[model samples]
Target: MMRRNDGCTILHAAVIGKCYSLAIGISESYPDLAGKRNEKGKTALHLLAAKPESFRSGSAYTLRGLGMKSLIPLLILRTIIYCCIPVLYKESQPVNSAEEPSNSASIHKLSRRSSFANYILGFPWLKEIDDARQSHAVAVMLAEKLIRREDWSHYVHTEFKVLEGSQFGISSEKKNRMPDPLIQATRLGIIEVVQEILSVYPEAAYTFDGKGRNILQIAVEEEKWFLYDYLMTSGTNMDRMLSAIDHEGNSIIHLAAHQESPPSTPPGVLEMMWEVLWFKRVQYDSYPYLWHLQNSDGKTAKQVFETNHASLREKAEETVRALANTVLIVSVLIATINFAAIFTVPGGFDQTTGEAIFLKNRRWEFSLLMFYLAGGLFSSLFTMGTLLVIIFLRFETEDFYVSLPCYYVINIISIFYSAVLAIVACCQALIVQKVVITDFRPLVVLFFIYGLMALVLMETSYVIFDYAYHLIRYCLCYRGQES
Candidate 1:
């Protein structure tokens, strides 16, 4: 058939619209249609590569129009079963006669052909490739399809061949090939797609793009944490992956050191904390030589991190200084209040005996007041001392992880103790006033409330202490591991 004015044939339009059935039918009848190009010199593959959305939506509409929507579930189930079937059966088959293909061989070939047919017709590649353009919903689907297809090796090779012929290659190996779909998926941060691609084609993870950046390098450079974490834990050879240097001589650590600014809401302290964690994790995961290795710029990983995170370090320092100052002020206020309360006892002193008027008469109440007052006074003093230490002490990065939480816990306990002391002292003052309480019910209620508040304070303090202890232990363990 003659091409349209825009040089797009019927098959080109169908592929562009993601009408797989129509495109397949047209291609089957006129195989030449697959090679036909549009006015922009883009073949059917180029049209499919335009954007995932165009093909995905078009395929769905086409499927519904053809009343094949119900078959999607069946196709998926068949794909799964087919993928799981052992390939060891292929090895068990007897040698085929050269004169004529054996039934088993024919059946195997037919099954492979049928699966590929289903792959092309069932919208397998399109769904994953398309969703990977924007999301990861169908990544597994794409991976399964690729793994299930007996000709997947040939298929991928042919696709690259077509890409090369189309002049998509820029510089290196231009006459040979271009980046595969898997490389493109990794660059796009479609983590599942990359995972699936690597699962089916493990060697693809090492394949570099035009810039000589592998999947791991791209993940670090793009700051895709999901992909990065997955790559780290997915049982890949960490030593090799980390050791890979890009064209610029930047290793994985160097790329990580170039991480961009964190989100604004988490405060600079957390940002710095995460930065430290990443630095430590990479150091732990990679070889010691990586730390000393210089990039193309002749800067080590530490140097790169320091240069990139200088502003972050400054911001973190400012945040910590502000926090410590605030805590110091609160501690001073609580200490002053507690110290003043010592002299201004709840009851007035006797004129001659020079003792609190209620101390002898209400010895129990006076003892309780003194106990809480002393507790608050000591806790506040301790908090103040800790705050001073925090302000003046030069903490290495690792030390802050252990010290900050402990300091915060002390500060919180001091505030709680002071508040409880103030409440108890006020109640004691009322008792000293000798207000008429013939009912006795009010006294019982006050005592119950005070007891409940004490219980709550004790429970909260215990929880904070437990949490801080575990955190410090973890920090110590982590530091030991690093050493």
Candidate 2:
């Protein structure tokens, strides 16, 4: 019943209503909503067919007080729904609304339509259902027509695949491999269909398709703006989707960042940018941070698009690289400022001045310092005490601009705080051990241990390689560096 302009046509809705309400032997399709009890087993078709008074063929009806004549073909096909109809039947009539199937073929086509819908909905069907596959073919043909007309959502809702091996089949994947429903729905701008499928098979949305293309990647490729819109506005944010790679190993942001320009054919690609970026999809791939992301060939989407479409590739590359440079500078500056306060570093911080002017920044210095120090201290302590047992806590990825692996940051910060508490801890341990006399032997061993600390520092730096690279790049960035 999905219409061209709107979603479902009144024609389809009426029929579906009948099929749903009436179990068998009647036109499953009708618009008599009063008799249509979606919640009740009293189907609209049953209500219509099981009229208080019986109607017969060739009857003048009102003339002798006889009921209405029979014209609705589906209503009449109910005598022997399974045996009477072949599931593969269809009409030769040029696709017209009036030209419904004469018998089992027509019923089969209708049955196919319903079955396909149920399959996509993850519902089981009865083995006795007839002419179901043929109806699926007709539905697919209709969806294809609608898609050509750019009524993507309508085509999408159909699932049009019960006709998989039928005469009008278009299942692109091999018999064993089918296109991802999420991708199919996305490519066709079928938001409702995608959502329904997701409800039935929520895992499918996250599955990468045959091309290694995730739903978001496919949506961007097809430029299904509305699908993109629905994805973001419906609470699926940019950061989450863009971060994921399709089976083909492409991220949606990578697709957007790499596309030379919006494909000339579809306007959806460029138009949906507003929705994606606004939702924090981490869309700007114009940075070196993302440059390292690789597809199956070890080339990123940027490399692929640039290779395929050279004219505008430089523009994309420049934008991404420049942005990455800026971020590098910002991160380095922040880390530098932080490092300055923590250690008596030679390059950036003046140790004597830092101590002398600790509170010289005056004004709210005392209160602000108290707040940050005390608060940061307690919060850090509490967090460590509560979270240390769970190692994965350090690895949790936040979607905020920082997108830092909190597990790493929290644990690293906690380690530093513990190092600072060494003096107190040592005092307590000393009280427990009662070893006050000079421990030259332990000190000598400790010196050897300190030598290993250098390697530990190097390993720790490597552990944060990606993050550290960004910081260092930011600090070192200069305008228009050659090569």
Best by lDDT: 1
lDDT: worst 10-residue window of model 2: 57-66
Clashing pairs in 1: none
Residue 156 C-alpha lDDT in model 1: 35
TM-score for each prediction?
0.53, 0.27
Positional deviation of residue 412's Cα in model 1 after best superposition, in angstroms: 5.6
- Compared with the true structure, the alpha-carbon lDDT of candidate 2 equals 0.38
Candidate lDDT values, in order = 0.57, 0.38
How do the residues 1-483 of candidate 1 rate in per-residue lDDT, one tens digit apiece?
Answer: 888899999877876665544454455456556566677655554444444344222233222122223343444444454343322111123365544323112111112435664466458754443333322122233233323231223223222222244222211212214325555555555554566557776765556666666677777766555467789778886656776666566767787787553232154755665565556555555666677788778898888988887777778777877887997888788778778888888777999999998788888767777776777788778878877876886655664345665675777766666666666665655655655353576568667777777656544344335345435544565532131
Query: Which residues of candidate 1, in runs, are more than 4 Å off?
Result: 1-198, 219-229, 261-267, 349-369, 394-483
267-304: candidate 2 lDDT, tens digit per residue: 22111222223222323322334445776567765466
How many residue-pair clashes does candidate 2 contain?
27
